[model samples]
Target: MDYHTIRPHPDLSSIVKCYWTLEVPYQNDAQRQLIVPDGCIEMIFILGDDVKRFTSGDEYIIQPRDMVLGQITEPFYVLPSGDVKSFAVRFYPYGFSNFVSISIGDLVNKETPLVSLFGNEVATALADKIRSAADTLERIELVDAFLLERLITKPTVDGIVKRTIDAIFSTKGKVSINTIVNDDSSKRRQLERKFLKEVGVSPKQLGKMIRLQSALKMLLNNHTGSLTEIAYESDYYNQAHFIKDFREFTGTTPKAFLGDEGMILSSVFYKQD
Candidate 1:
């Protein structure tokens, strides 16, 4: 397994978090992989065989080669049909909304075809450019160019929403919404509504996801501490609080997630980052 992330062009850094690629050797029988939410959205382009996304225990749909995966609220499963090769654009929590007119909330927990966001012709041209690029670097250039074209008339991000998201990330989700809005009820409601439109999740939801991500990073990095310690480090009130949040996002206990074959992808992805 090989996973790597590259910084976006300096000009686009505010919107594009990074460009990431993952390549895993083929397995005759690929194990299902568990993917948990992390408070951001992604646009993925698969360059290998079709992968199956499990909607239920025994049902799944093959993911589109080029699609945008919206804000995920729960754990989902997927399995590779063969060797895995994928490249994706990871967007900041408040970034994607600038490119589309629709409310981001409508896209939660789903993979919508890129054509749905961009028109069919534009989507097809962009996908072709990405897929035919000679290498990852070339692909990045193409993607950057595509985004630049669309960003000519950059949509203004809500100032409060942007600041709130920044605070959540800077504190690893320890900051409360009240702190973010400074206890103004009107501001809080406004932020909530704007957050849904721009980030696809409420401020509280995004904070929880960010906090869980911190815990996951700790565990994956081999922190020599107990779950209780991880919980405190992540700002949870107690071990029970940590466990409850962990299971909510990952669909399993921390110990079980560590031992599960379904987490191979997440383990590698997080470890590399």
Candidate 2:
């Protein structure tokens, strides 16, 4: 697998984390890949072969060629039907809500066809442009133009929500929800309701996902840390707590994940990011 990310245009940087591409050769008996949550949404365009997302041990639906993957709260499995070539826009936690009118909560744990969000005519045109672009640079330019138009008409994110998200990422998710709320304890419930509507998960869930991402990155990149040390660095209470949370999202122990073939794509992603 080959994976890489590109910085977004300056104008879109606050909303878009980056643009990423992945290419993988096809094999007759390719193994399904594990996709862990990272507290962000993605607009994905599959340019090569179709991909399958499994909802059960033996069942899956073919993913739409162009779609938005909502904020994921749990890990899932996916495999390519053939050669895999994909381009995607990774949005910040609060970014995607600005693009469409539907509640982000409705999109959780599913691939929403772009047509449903943008309308068929507009979505078709955009997909065509992406498919016909001469290169990645041209594709980026096309997407940038599309988003600039949306940005003009869409409402801005709530000030509190934006700042809280920023703080979470800045602290690598070690910041507490009370701190995110700035001790305005009465607003916590209201904030969580709004957060679920716009971000597809509560602030607390996003924190856990981001914190796990930090530890996953550490484990993938450095081989020196003991599990306890990694747990500490990631701000967990202890090794047991870290492993428990990790398993909830990844469905496997950290030690097993590092060497699993299913983790190849995830490993490459963490290493590159």
Candidate 3:
């Protein structure tokens, strides 16, 4: 298994978080891997075998070869059908809305094919170019060109939404929405409406996801003293609170998460980020 990430072009740095790739050899006994919410949307291209996203016990769906995976609110599982190879663009919380007219909230917790979002003709042609590109750099160039073209006329992200997201990140999600809006009920409601439309989640949900990502990096890197210490460091009220949030986002306890085989891919991602 191999996983890596590359920085996006400077022009796209604000909206695009990064470009990432993953490759894993085929294994008949491969286990289902847990994928947790990380507060980012992704544009993915599956260049290898199909992958199954489990919907319920022993039931699944084959993900599209080229798709946009929207904001996930809960943990889910995916298993590769064969050797895995993929290239993806990771977007900031408010980033994807700028490229499409559809409400981001409508895309939660599922994979929508690029054709569905970009239309058949344009999406098909773009996918063909990506598939035929010489290498990762060429693919990056192609996507950059495509996104740049769309950037010209697409609507900009809502200011309140972007600023709220910025506050969440700056404070490691510890800051309260009430404080951000100065306890203004009207402003808070307005923020919530815009967030759901443009960012695909409520301000509070995005905050918890961001906070969990911080805790995950600490847990993965072995940089914290103990669960209690980590909880406090991450601004949770107590260890139990930390564990609850951990389980909510990751579907596992912090201690169990450390050595879990299902977490290898997620571990690589958090550790690197």
Candidate 4:
């Protein structure tokens, strides 16, 4: 398996997080890999064979070659049908909304084909260009151009929503919504509504997701301490609290997460800076 990421263009640095690519050889006895929420949205282009996302026990659906994966609240599993080659754009929590008119909430926990979001003609053309591009650099150039065109006419993100997300990141998801709104009930309601539309999750959920990512990095990087210490470092109140949130987002305990074969893909992702 080979995985890596590249920084986005300067003009798009704020909204676009980074571009990433992955390649893995086909294994005869490949296990289904578990993927957890990471508080980001992604635009993905599958360049090699198909991949399957399990919808339920022993049942699955093939993912589109080109699609947008929204903010997932829980863990899911996917298995490549054969050798895997994919290119994707990872957007900030509030970043993807700046380019589309559809409610971001509508995209949660599922893969929506690019044609569904961007019209068939436009999406098909872009997918063709991405597929035919000579290499990763060329694909990045094409995607940047495509996004830049849409971004020019789109309105700026809502101030309340952006600020809330900023606070979440700055505090590593430890900041409460009440603190953000200064205990104002009306303002809290408004923020909740805005978050549902713009971020596809409540402020608290996003915060927890961000906090979980921090704890995941520590665990994956072999932080020298007990799980309780790691949890405290991640801003959780205690070990039990940390385990609850960890299980909520990842569907596994922290100790179980490490050395779990199903976590190979997620480990590669969180291990990155």
Candidate 5:
């Protein structure tokens, strides 16, 4: 398996963190990969064989074509049916809402036809353009073009969500609702409702995930610190709190996570900023 990421068009940078691609040769031996929560949403287009998805014990197929998946709240797995190739976009917590009509939360852990959200012809055209591109750069460029020409621009959602995300991401999970709310009265509740509706997880959950991400990086970078020290550095309440959050996010203790082959992919995605 090979994975790479490219920067998104400036227009989408506010919500879309980056676009990524994964290519794996046809191999029956390679059982599909199961991806868990990373506190973000994504839109993926399969350029090769049909992508098989399983969630909530439900099996759905993403035709060897274009599809946009909503926020992922639970765990899911995908197996390559054949010469597996895919292009995916990683959207920041609230990024996807600007482009789709439905409340972003309604789409979490769900893969819906782009036609439903974006008209059928437009979705198909974009998918075809991406698939027909000669290379990743070309595909990325096509994606850039598609968004520029066809993506719906919502100023209100854009301003509110973007501001909130900026506060959290810039602070590296060291902020709270109060910080994001600024001086708006009832800002905490308003932000919470919007965040939960648009981003799937609450601001606090994303903050914890972000902090865990920072701590994992510090440890992996050989910062010469104990888990306790790293925990404090990461801004967890205490060592025990750190341990609990770490396990909750990663499904394993920090010590056990180190040098674990099964966790290699997750580690790469979660390690530090």
Candidate 6:
């Protein structure tokens, strides 16, 4: 299992975290990888076999070549086909809204095909350019160009959604529904409706997802840190509580997770909040 991460270009730095490429050589039957829940959205370019995304008790097939994955609101798992080789550009929760007219909330509950949202030809071209690129940096540039072009066509974030997103980031995903609501709960309801339509998930769900994403980053990048320490730092009540939440999202224990090379191949794909 090998993984490489490349930073996004300056023009896109605020929206895109980085482009991540993974290569896994088959040795034998490997355990299915448990990809914990996270907040950010991704545009995955499959260079080899297909990838399976399991969420909310359902399985969605991500065919080899190209696709865009929206913000994951619920816990999910993924398993690579016989041999794994893929690359993806990870986008910040707020950054994605800039490229599409829809709200960040709409991307939550599912994975929509990039072709449907961005058009088949455009999606295919972007994926091909990235897969054919000689280096990670070049791939980043190509993705940046793709986003820049879309930004011209998409609607900018409205004041209400902008304010709501600001609150989420400020609270580090701990923002309550009450906080986002106006004096009346009507705002909350409207937000929920809009969020589901544009972002694909509720504001509360995205907050939890973002919070979990932070925890995963620390655990994967700061390997020396203990799970208990990570849990506390990530704002979970305690180690036991954290493990329960983690397992609920990932379908496996954290310690066992580190031992699986295939699991590590995917976990490293998440971009820290």
What overall lDDT goes with each candidate model? 0.91, 0.91, 0.92, 0.92, 0.71, 0.69
lDDT of 3 by residue, 168-216 (tens): 9999999899998999999999999999899999999999999999888
Residues 1-273 of candidate 2: C-alpha lDDT, one tens digit per residue = 788899998988888999998888899979989999998899999999999999998899999999999987777999999999999999998989998877899999999999999999999999999999998899999999999988985448988788778888999989999876777878898888888888999889998999999999999987598999999999999999999999999899999999899998888887887
Residue range 1-273, candidate 1, lDDT tens digits: 888999998878998899999898999867999988888789999999899999988899999999999999998899999989999999999888878899999889989999999989999999999988999999999998888888877548988888888999999999999977789999899899999999999999999999998999999998999999999999999999999999988889999999998998888877775
In model 4, the clashing pairs are none
lDDT string for model 5 (1-273, tens) is 677778888777776788888776887565545454666777778877876765446565654365666655444566667886888888878767666666777776677677777888988888778777899888888777776665655434646666767777788788876755775758777777787777877777777767777887787777788888998888888889998887775556788777655455555555422
lDDT (C-alpha) at residue 60 in model 3: 99
List pairs with backbone clashes in candidate 3: none
Worst 10 residues of 3 by lDDT: 153-162
- Residue pairs in candidate 1 whose N, alpha carbon or C atoms collide under 3 angstroms: none
Model 4 regions more than 4 Å off: 153-155
As for lDDT, the candidate ahead, 4 or 5, is 4
Candidate 2: C-alpha RMSD to true structure equals: 1.3
Q: Is candidate 3 or candidate 6 better by TM-score?
A: 3
- Give TM-scores for every candidate, taking all chains together and pairing residue i with residue i: 0.97, 0.97, 0.98, 0.98, 0.81, 0.77
How far in Å is the alpha carbon of 104 misplaced in model 1?
0.8
Instruction: State the lDDT of candidate 4 residue by residue for 137-197, as single tens digits.
Output: 9999999999999888544888988999999999888888998899999999999889988
Global fold similarity of model 6 (TM-score) = 0.77
Question: How much lDDT does candidate 2 score?
Answer: 0.91
Off by over 4 Å in 5: 26-36, 50-65, 81-83, 152-155, 158-160, 179-185, 222-224, 270-273
Backbone clashes in model 6: 10
Number of residue pairs clashing in candidate 4, backbone atoms closer than 3 angstroms, sequence gap of 3 or more or interchain:
0
The residue-by-residue lDDT of candidate 6 on 42-72, one tens digit each, is 8877776677765445556555357667765
